[model samples]
Target chain A: MGYHHIHRYRIAFVDCDPAQIVHFSNYFRWFDTASREFFTACGVPSWRDTERGSGLIGTPLVDAQASFRNPATYGEDIEIESWVDRWSGKSFVMRHVARRGDTVLAEGREVRVFAVRDSVDPPVIRAVAVPAGIRAMCGD
Target chain B: MGYHHIHRYRIAFVDCDPAQIVHFSNYFRWFDTASREFFTACGVPSWRDTERGSGLIGTPLVDAQASFRNPATYGEDIEIESWVDRWSGKSFVMRHVARRGDTVLAEGREVRVFAVRDSVDPPVIRAVAVPAGIRAMCGD
Candidate 1:
C-alpha cells in the first residue's frame, strides 16, 4: 500500500458514446491520468525533469485492465482514487477505483514500467529498473 | 472465429503524452472503434437502430486488456485488426492487433456483453443473452 491520490474530472459529451453512457475506454484514460497524479502527490519529479537528469522518460504500461461496474453519463463529475498496489524490480502495479457520488463506476489496474528512449530511428523504448529514490518518496 | 475488420486512423498530437509517444490508453480507444467496425462489417445494424427495434443499447465491455509491444508517436498511422474470438451465451470476446506497417504495436482483448438500459433514474444497464441473429450475422 502506498499513497492514494484522488483525481477529479467532469465527463464531457465526447467522452460518451451514442448509447449516452461514458465509453469504457475513457475510464482507462482517466485511470492513466490518476496514476500520474499519484506519483505527483508522492513528490516524484515530472518525467521531463527526470529525463533531463536520469534518462527516465516516463512510465509506460505493459498491461492495463478495467472492469466496468455501472454506467455514467456526460456532465457527471467523477473521482478516481488511485494507489500503487505493488512494486517489483522493473515494474509496478497501479490500482484505481472510479466513483460518482457514492456509486462505484469502474475499477482499473495497470502494470507499468519506467522507460527511456532506446532508439530514435524505429522509435523504440526500453524499461529500466525501478528508481530507488522515487520508490522511497512513495514510501514503499 | 468471425470476420476480421481493419480500422485505420492517424494519431493526433493530443493522443501523445509529454513523453512524445502515443499514450497507451489511446490503444483502448482504437480497439473499441475497431470492435464496432467489426460488427458493421458483419452486416449488423448500428446500436441506435437496434435499440429502436429490439431494445439493444450496445455492447459494453466488462473487461478490457491490452499489452503494449512497441511505442508509437504522434502523426503515425496505425491499423487495428479486430475480430470476435469467442461467443458465449451472454458475452463474447473481441481481439485486436494494432500494427504500424509491418511492425506490431499492441494486442488487445475485450470481454463484452450486449446491454440494454435497465433503469433511467440512475442510468443502469444490464447484459442480455447474446442474440442469435447477431451471432449468425457474425458467422459464428
Candidate 2:
C-alpha cells in the first residue's frame, strides 16, 4: 500500500531451468522489466522510445548483483515490490523484493546512473544529481 | 582435461553491479555463458546455427532458486564450474559454483529438461530423454 512503487508479474515457462526452478538470471530480467514498467507508469518515456530515438538519455546498468533467498519455478505467480530510497547527484538506489503471496523469494538493490549518448566508447557515467522532476515524483 | 562434465567460472567485476556485489539475476546469464561454452566445446552445435533454428531440443528450466552464502563484488573473481550429473531421458542436472580462488561465493544446482515446442493452452513441457551425444559427454 505504498505509493513508492509496485510491479506485478507471472513466471513464464521460459523463465525456469532444468531443475524446474526459475534460473537466477531471469530474476534480473524480471527486475528490469518491472522497474521499467513502473517508471513508464510514472510518466517517464520508454527507454526504447526516448527522445524520438535521439538517445539523449539512457539508464544503462553500470553495475548489478543479486542474492538468491529461495527458488521460483514455472507456473508461479509473484509480485515485486520496489522503492527509490536514496539518491545522489548522478546515481540513485532501487530496491526490490520478490514474493509469492507472503513468501519472500528474493531481495535485491541496484545502483544506477543517468548516461548521455556518446559517439565513441561507452556513455560517460557520472555522479551527477538526480533530475528535479524525477525527485519530485519519487519524493525525496 | 578429462571430460569431467563440469566447468567452473570465477565471478568478476564485469559480472557484478554497482552494489559492489553480485546481483542475484546476473547468475543466470553467467550460467548460460558457461554452459554454452561447455556444450560447444563438447560438440553441441552453436545454439543458433542448429538446423531447427535452435532445435526442438531445448534446455528449459523447470525450477530454479538460490541462496546467498556470501557476497561477491568488483574486481573479485569467483569460480563457476558446472556439470551434468543426472540424466533420465529428457531431464538433467546442471550445478554451478561461484567461488573466489578458494572461498565459495555461492553454490547451486538447477534441474532442467529438454522439451519440444508445444503450441497449446499452456505449453506442455514434456520430458524427452537426454540425447545420446550429450549423455556420453556429461554422464562422466
Candidate 3:
C-alpha cells in the first residue's frame, strides 16, 4: 500500500456523451490524473523535474482496466481516490475508485512503468526499472 | 463474432502528452468510436433512431480494458479494427485492435450493455436485454 490521495473533479458538459452520461473513457483519464496527484502528494517531483535530473520522462501506462458501476451526469461533482496497490521492479499498479456522494461510480486499475526516451532516430520510449528513492517517497 | 469494421484516425498534437507520445487514455476513446463504427457498418440504426422507436439509449460500457504494446506519436495515422467478441442476454463484449502500419499499438476489450433511461428523479440508466434484430444484423 502507498499513500492515498483524493482528486476532485466536476463533470463538465463536454465530458458527457449524447446518452447524457459520462463517457466510460473519461474515467481512465481521471484515474491517470489521480495517479499523478498521488505521486505529488508523496513528494515526488514533476516529470519535467525528473527528466532534467534523471532522464526519466514519466510513468506511462502499459495496461488499464475499469469497471463502471453507476452512471453520472454533467454538473455532478466526483472524487477519485487513488493509491499504488503494488510495486514491481519495473512497474507499479495503481488503483482508483471514483465516487459521487456515497455511490461508487467506477473503479480503475492501471499498470504503469517509468520510462525514458530511447536513443533512436525516430524517437522511441523504453520502460526503465522503478527508481528506489521515488518508491521510498511513495512509501515502500 | 460479428462483422468487423476498421476506423481510421490521425493522431493530433493535442493527443500527445509531455512525453511526446500519445496518451494511453486516447486508445480507449478510439476503441469506443470503432465499436460504434462496427455497429454502423452492420446497418444498425443510430442510437437516436433506436431511442425514438425502442426507448433504447445506447450501449454503455460495464467494463473496459486495454493493453498498450507500442507508443505512438502525433501526425501518425492509425487504424482500429473492432467487432463483437461475445454476446449474452444483457451484455456483449467488444474487441478492438489498434495498429500503425505493421505495428500493433494497443488492444482493447469492452463489455457493454444496451440501456434505457430509468424513471428516476436524478436520471438513472438500466441495462436491457440484447435485441434480437440488432444481434442478427450484427451477424450473431
Candidate 4:
C-alpha cells in the first residue's frame, strides 16, 4: 500500500460520444492527470523543476491498461483515486480507479519510467533509473 | 487473422506533451479510430445503421492495453493497422499496431462487446451476444 490521491473531474459535453457515454479514451487521460496529482500530493517538485536540476524530465508511460466497467455521461462528476502500486529499479506501476458516486466506471494501470533527454543533436528520450528521493517522496 | 485496415494520421502539436513526445493516451485514440476503419473496410454498416436495424448501438470497449516501444513527436506521419484477433460468444479482441515508417511505436489490444441501450427510463448500456452477421462481415 502507498499514499493515495483523488482527482475530481466533471465530464464535459465534448467528452462523450454519439452513444452519449464518455469516450473510453478519456479514462486514460484522466488516469494520467491523476498520476500527476498523486505526485503533487506527495510533495514532489514539478517536472520542469526536476528537469532543470537533474535532467529528469518526467515519467513516461511504457505500458498502460484500463478496464471499463460502467459508462458515464456528460454533466456527471467523477473522481479518480490513484497510487503507486509497485516500483522497480527503472520503472514503476501506478493504479487508478474512477467512480461516479458509488458506481465504478473504470480501472487503469500504467507502467512508467523516469526519462531524460539524450545527448544527440535532436535529443531523444531515454529511460533512467528511478530516483530514490522521488520515490521516497511518494511515501510508499 | 482478419481483414485489416490502416488509419493514417499526422501528429499534431497539441497531441504532444511538454516533454515533446506524443502523449501515450493519444495512441489509444488512434487505435480506436482504426477499429472503426477496420469495420468499414470489412463492409459492415455504420453503427447508426446497426442501432436502427438491430439495436446494436456500437462496439464498446471492455478492456484495453497498450505497450509503447518508441516515442513519436509532432509532424510525424504514423499509421495504425487494426484487425480483429479473436471472437467469443459475447466479445471480440482487436489488435492494433502503430508505426512510423519502419519503426514500431506502439501495439494495442482491446476487448470489445456489442452494446444496446437498456429499456430503463434513463437508458443504460448493456453488452449483448456477438452478432453473427456482424462477425461475418468483419471477415474473421
Candidate 5:
C-alpha cells in the first residue's frame, strides 16, 4: 500500500447537470486530478519533466470504473482520497473515494499505464513497464 | 437494438493534458453527452420534463469504462456513435465508439439507471425499472 493523497474542491455549476447533481463523469475528472496529486506527493516530477528526461509522456488510463453512491450538488465541498491500490508489470490500479464529510459519494478505480509517445505524426502512445524509480518513490 | 446517435464536436485546448492529448476522463464526459443524445434521438423527453411528469430525474451512471485505441489532440473533429447496448430491469448499458474518419480513437461503455429523487433534504436518488415506453421509443 502506498501513501494516500487527498485533493479537495468545491463543486461548480458546470459540474452539475439538469438533474441538479454533480455529473458522474466529473468524479472521474476529479479522480484523475487526485491521481496526479498522489504522484506529486510521492515526489515524482511532472509529466512534462519526465517526458523530457525519459520519454515518459504520462500515465494514461486504460480502464476506469465508478459507482455512484450519493447525490451531491454545486456549492458542496468534497474531497477525493486517492492511492495506488495495485501495481503490475506494465499497469497499476489507482483507487479513489469521493466524500462530503462522512458520506461516501462515489468510489472509483482506474487501471493506468505509463506511456510514451511512440509516433509523432497522428500521435500514438505505447505503454511501458512500471518504472523502478517510480515504484520505489510510491512505496510499492 | 436502439438507433445509433452520432454526436460530433471539436476537441478544445482545455480538453488536453500536458501530454497534448485529450485526457482520458474527457472520453467519459463525451460518452455521457452521447448517452443523452441517444435518448433525444429516440424521442424521449428531457430530464426536466420527465421529472415533472413522472418523478424521473435523469439517468445516472453507476459504472463507466473506456479503452483508448489512439491519441487525439486539440482542434480535432471527432464523432461518437452511441446506442443502448443492453436493457435490464433497472439499468442499461450505453456503448460508444469515437472516431475520426475510419480510425477508432476510443471505445466506452456506461452502466446507468433511471433515477428519481426519493428524498428532499440532502437529496437522495433511487433507481427505477426501465420504462416500457422509453424502451420502445428507443427501439430496444
Candidate 6:
C-alpha cells in the first residue's frame, strides 16, 4: 500500500568533495534530502507548521549512524532508497541506501521520536503516539 | 595545536529543495560536512586518524529548529557559519548560520557529544575540550 519507499537522485556537480569524489559526508546529506523528499512526496512537510501549514510530524532525533560502501563521484546519477524500517508508539526508524549504477555508496539509519506537538509560545508538549492511521503506509 | 572542531560550508546546488529553495534540512547536511572539513582543515582527518580524530559524533538531534529569512536558490553561493556555541563537560553545542548575498536563508544549530575515546576496535570517542587553538581560524 505504498508502505515501503525508495527515492532516487542524480549526483550533481556540487555534490562532490574536494577530492572530486562524492564526499563521505555528502551521503548523509543526500540521505537526509531524499528522506525529506520521500515524506514530501507523501504530502508530509517538515517538523513544524509554524506558519500553520499543519504537518503530521514533530519529532526529535534520538540516534543515527552511516556506513560508507563505495566511492561516488560528481555528475553521477544515484538512487537513494528510504523507508520506515520501524515505527512504534513513540519512535520511528528510517533506513537510507544510496547507490550509483548498481554500486552502493552508503547505508545509514536515523531513529527518532514523535516527542512533541503544538507550539512553543506556551509550549503544549506531549508524547505523541505514532498515529494508527499512518501505519498501513509505513514499511515496518 | 591542531584541534578538530565543527565548521560550516557554502551550500551548493545539490543542497536545494524541489521549490528550488534551500530546504531547511540541507542546512544540517552542510553543517555536518563543513564541520568535518573544519576538522580536516585543522589537519585532523577523522576517518584517517581515528586515534586523534574526534570519532563519530553520534549526533542524534536533541533539538533543531530554524528561522528562514530569505530563499536560497540552486547554484547560488551561500556561506554557512558555524561555531561551538556552548560546551559542558558532557556535551557541546554548534550553531550554524546560512547566508546568500547578505540575505540570511536559515539559522540553526546542532547539539553533539563525543561518546568515547582511544579504543582499538570500537574507536575512540570523548567530549574533548573545544581546543582554543583554532577558534580564530574558523571565524572567517
Q: Is candidate 2 or candidate 3 better by lDDT?
A: 3
lDDT of 6 by residue, B1-140 (tens): 22334343455667554333455456656776665565567554354344335443333233333444555556566777666676555555667777775776666655654433344322223445444433444442
Cα-based lDDT for every prediction: 0.90, 0.61, 0.92, 0.92, 0.90, 0.56
Going through the candidates in order, their DockQ values are: 0.77, 0.10, 0.84, 0.78, 0.67, 0.06
Q: What is the TM-score of each candidate against the true structure?
A: 0.94, 0.52, 0.97, 0.97, 0.93, 0.49
Q: Where is model 5 chain B poorest over a 10-residue stretch in terms of lDDT? A: B117-126
How many Å off is the CA of B27 in candidate 6?
8.2
> Which stretches in model 6 have alpha-carbon errors above 4 Å?
A40-60, A115-127, B1-140
Q: Which candidate is the best by TM-score?
A: 3
- Tens-place lDDT per residue, model 6, A1-140, is 24545677777778663334554556656666666676666665455552244334444444555665555665567888887887777877778888777877678777655544455332234446775644543423
| Per-residue alpha-carbon lDDT of candidate 2 for residues A1-140, written as tens digits (9 for 90 to 100) | 22356688788878775445676677777776766666776677765565345443544444444555656677778998877656777777677888989988777666666554433322123333556665565545
lDDT of 1 at B17: 76
Higher-ranked by DockQ: 1 or 4: 4
> Which candidate leads in DockQ?
3
When 1 and 4 are scored with TM-score, the better candidate is: 4
Model 2, stretches more than 4 Å misplaced? A48-56, A120-128, B1-28, B35-140
For model 5, the local distance difference test gives 0.90
Q: Which DockQ-derived CAPRI band holds candidate 4?
A: medium
Candidate 4 has what TM-score?
Answer: 0.97
List model 4 lDDT by residue over B1-140, tens digit each. 56888899999999989898899999999999899888888888889998899989899999999999998898999999898899999999999999999999999999999999986434489999999988888876
**Worst-scoring 10-residue span by lDDT in model 6 chain A:** A50-59
Off by over 4 Å in 1: none
Q: Model 2 TM-score?
A: 0.52
lDDT of 5 by residue, A63-82 (tens): 88888888899999999999
With candidate 5 superimposed using the best TM-score fit, by how many Å does residue A40's alpha carbon deviate from the native? Answer: 0.7
lDDT of 2 at B136: 70
Quality of candidate 1's docking, in CAPRI categories? Answer: medium
User: What 10-residue stretch in candidate 4 chain B is worst by lDDT?
Assistant: B116-125
Global Cα lDDT for candidate 1: 0.90
